[model samples]
Target: MMASQRGDVSAVRALFVSQRASPYDVTPSNCGPLRFAIESGSLELVQFLCHNGADVNTTFGTFETSPLEWAYKTRQIEIARFFLRQGARLDYLCFRGWTPVVLLFQESSPTVPLEFFGLLSGHSFSDFDVQDRFGVTALHRAARWGSVGDVHALLQLGASPTLTDNEQRWTAAFWAASANNVATLKRLTEGAPSNFIDHVDFRGWSILHVAIEAGGLETMCLVLELGVDPHQTIMVESEDSCVMEELTATEFARTKGQATYRCFTQALQLTGYNISVIEDSDTELVFWDT
Candidate 1:
């Protein structure tokens, strides 16, 4: 901790040299010199630890997390690459809800090693898109909270937008829609399903319905451009438990919880609030997850 905090690479080097027994130990919370350096953005210290025989691929403790994952997650993309070239596997999925890609994209603009990110680009995978405990993919996180830079990095790394999570639902398209990021959504759906936008959750609403209900005009327009029919009809069960003609986006959402009718009802007029998706159904009223 002292050496890491002070950025004393020399003392750290002498203490952990391979020739020594090494009184200090590496750990997760109290990461050894390398992790601490990565954590603190001390590239100098990181270089020292690596030169002194720190295992670049070592999992600190909890989550089986490696130095590469931390470096990626905390904006040390270069450091992550250094670890990877030293024998870290870029695709290794740990117990935590993260792969190196997840770590790379979680921040506004995560650290992306140019050569490494470039190396993973131009790749493709039918089954490599893995999800963590929440059933979210690296693509999901990037399109949701990441910058265009991060988006481009993962895209180059060959993350599959079509990959689904554990729920057997939610593609990268759904996540982009929910995030209201039209640009990223456009990039992620290049070769997806024709009715991909029409994919309803356990419920019967499609992605367009979600955007419309959420008042995401940009997202709605993008989906429409991607082939979502704006005038599609959706069945809604009224408060009286009776089926009704729900035209426009708000009604469909209100009845089914798209955009809370009561919560944002006051500003419902924002997106032609009164208008909603038209309705039609077999019979029984049921809630669907989108």
Candidate 2:
């Protein structure tokens, strides 16, 4: 990105023209002129970095965060596009996180530029298969960060909100409501399958548990209107999900490794809206959020 930022044609030319037969290491710590230029929004420098052997996918630090993450967090869509053009990988899996796409969703962010969207539209992010250390998905990231635009973009680009992380876990809907994103929640619920209302995690957490933790009335109402169980259990059942226990031939294709999906409907039938009893019962409803 720095190389692109710098707009140094020579630098760009030099990077791709490596004489060595091997690839140059562009780790974040070792990044030079390109990193500096990218951080400073020097498109010329970023161009140079991409042209040279500066990695479009380079993570500046060993923290697993990448320059692309920085670009998204800063809403520097131009810089992000430059990297994408240079072949940076978008969408990560089997990891904790690549960068902070969530920051893009915040209400506090500046108006995102159209160039970023154009670039994003042109590329296919690998978020569908990407997972974080906790088995969280890019959808989870969008939900946690409340980046509905990003979520919509990802969905439009073929990401599955139904996918589970490494843990076979939460849906994008769960995370969205947890982060108090009413719009995201509405979209998720309105478009989800019938069983989603009863979906529970291994710990048996319906999306409502997550939403109450966030404590927004609109979020709660949105979730409620969508029909999640007010009395859903948080403790995951220590058995295979009933949804997938049937014969393989009968089972339609599902997100790999996800025993859990949206089932708030079942959970609601199991536990009606009775927060007071849960608030009073010490052991029976001990998992209740205080």
Candidate 3:
């Protein structure tokens, strides 16, 4: 393990060849030399370990990830590709619904390379929409991180922007709004019509509502321009009962502060909305509508 972590390929080879060590030898943590080699970022050591019969699919660490996943998490694209070529499962979901495709977007820098997506796709099952345990697809991950290029690549690779995560059913637009990433949101809604920008999450929060809650004044204005009503409300349902709470966009803005409220009101006027109707105290609603 030490020699592998340090990229001492000859020592590793000698150990295996002299029968003094098993290529499968693992630490108390179940981590083998291949995992170390991947962490070391040495492709030569990785190749040597694999040639000497290291398990490409070995699951280790807290996430119980495969060697390919470690390579990805460590940003070793070449090593990851080598594992894929050695028959690592691209669709394999480790802890938290992480697959090679999801990892490529989630762990990669915003400066995504086209070749990375292409490589993963070539080895994948053509299911770009595969979600993790949390139901987060490649699109959701990319959009949440504001990686526009990754979003484009995933969409071109057949990933659906409408797919939601398991926890909140957050769509690509929803995730972008949650992160206050107007750039990603614009890219996502480029060809989308006005109605398409009105997409809501599991809580019934529209993109405008989410943007306001995210405290992005610019994004709020952008959504209004895209045609989301300023008076839009998000319905929150409690698990204990069937009762629902309607939280208006204005209310969300007000809670943010006087400045946010001013921005919200101004955005409404700029979009040609009747600001008075939204501000009417009689229209005020509580968390519990009962």
Candidate 4:
């Protein structure tokens, strides 16, 4: 395992030959030799292990991640492609319901090959909307990270923007709302049905509410222009640590906006007005006084 982890192809080969070590043995660490080789980013060692009957589909750790997932996590594009050619499942779920595609987007680096994404997209079993244990899909991950390109790619691969995660039932739009990612939200809304953007969480926090509290005035304006109701309200609990309060989106925005700046009130008024009035105005509106 140490040899493989160190990318020591020759040493691994020598140890394997001398000890008759089986590459298929899953160690107590929940990581197999092939998975270790993958973590080393050594293409040669990985190929050798696979040739020696290393199970590319073997899952380990709490996430049940396969070698293909390890490849994606390690940015081992060639190894990833090799595993795919060897019949690795495209939508294999790892820890927390994360598929390789979902995990790929979770990577902090941006240099991953487009071909890899394309390969996963081309796979017949690639379930674009496959959710994690949290019910968060690739779209949710991409939206949370502000990964616009990956969000677009996932959508093109037939990922549904309407699907929501388990707990909050927050759609991709809602994820974008929480993250204040207007560009990603716009991409998601493109060609969507007129009413598609009108959803809220299980708590009844409207898209307008989310946009206003987490997003700035521009985002609030965008959501309203996209046809969200500014008058939307949800009954939220805990006014005095135990009481419930029903607040309109406008009022909620004002309350939340006060913590950051005084300008959120203006945002509420702009959207809270009759939609007809906003549409009729030719003058540009400023949300804040600089």
Which residues of candidate 4, in runs, are more than 4 Å off? 107-112, 215-217, 261-263, 266-290
Residue lDDT tens for model 1, 216-260 = 656766766676654567766666757565655444545545445
**TM-scores of all candidate predictions against the true structure:** 0.70, 0.60, 0.81, 0.84
Off by over 4 Å in 1: 11-30, 110-116, 119-128, 148-157, 230-248, 253-290
| Model 1: lDDT of residue 234 | 71
Q: Count the backbone clashes (under 3 Å) in each candidate.
A: 9, 58, 4, 3
RMSD of each: 7.2, 10.8, 5.1, 5.8
Q: In angstroms, what RMSD does candidate 3 have relative to the true structure?
A: 5.1
Per-residue alpha-carbon lDDT of candidate 3 for residues 70-176, written as tens digits (9 for 90 to 100): 77667788997888889887667788767766666553365566777777766655877877767878788788783777777777787777777778767888888
Looking at model 1, report the run of 10 residues with the lowest lDDT sum.
119-128
Pick by TM-score: 1 or 2, better one: 1
Better of 3 and 4 by lDDT: 3
Q: Candidate 3: misplaced stretches above 4 Å?
A: 10-21, 193-195, 235-247, 269-290
In terms of lDDT, model 2 sits at 0.55
lDDT of each: 0.62, 0.55, 0.75, 0.74
Error of 3 at 59 (Å): 2.3
Clashes of 3: 4
TM-score of 2: 0.60
lDDT of 4 by residue, 209-245 (tens): 7776684677777787788765567786655676778
lDDT of 1 at 17: 67
Per-residue alpha-carbon lDDT of candidate 2 for residues 77-144, written as tens digits (9 for 90 to 100):
77877777666776641134543444344445544454555565567444443555666655666655
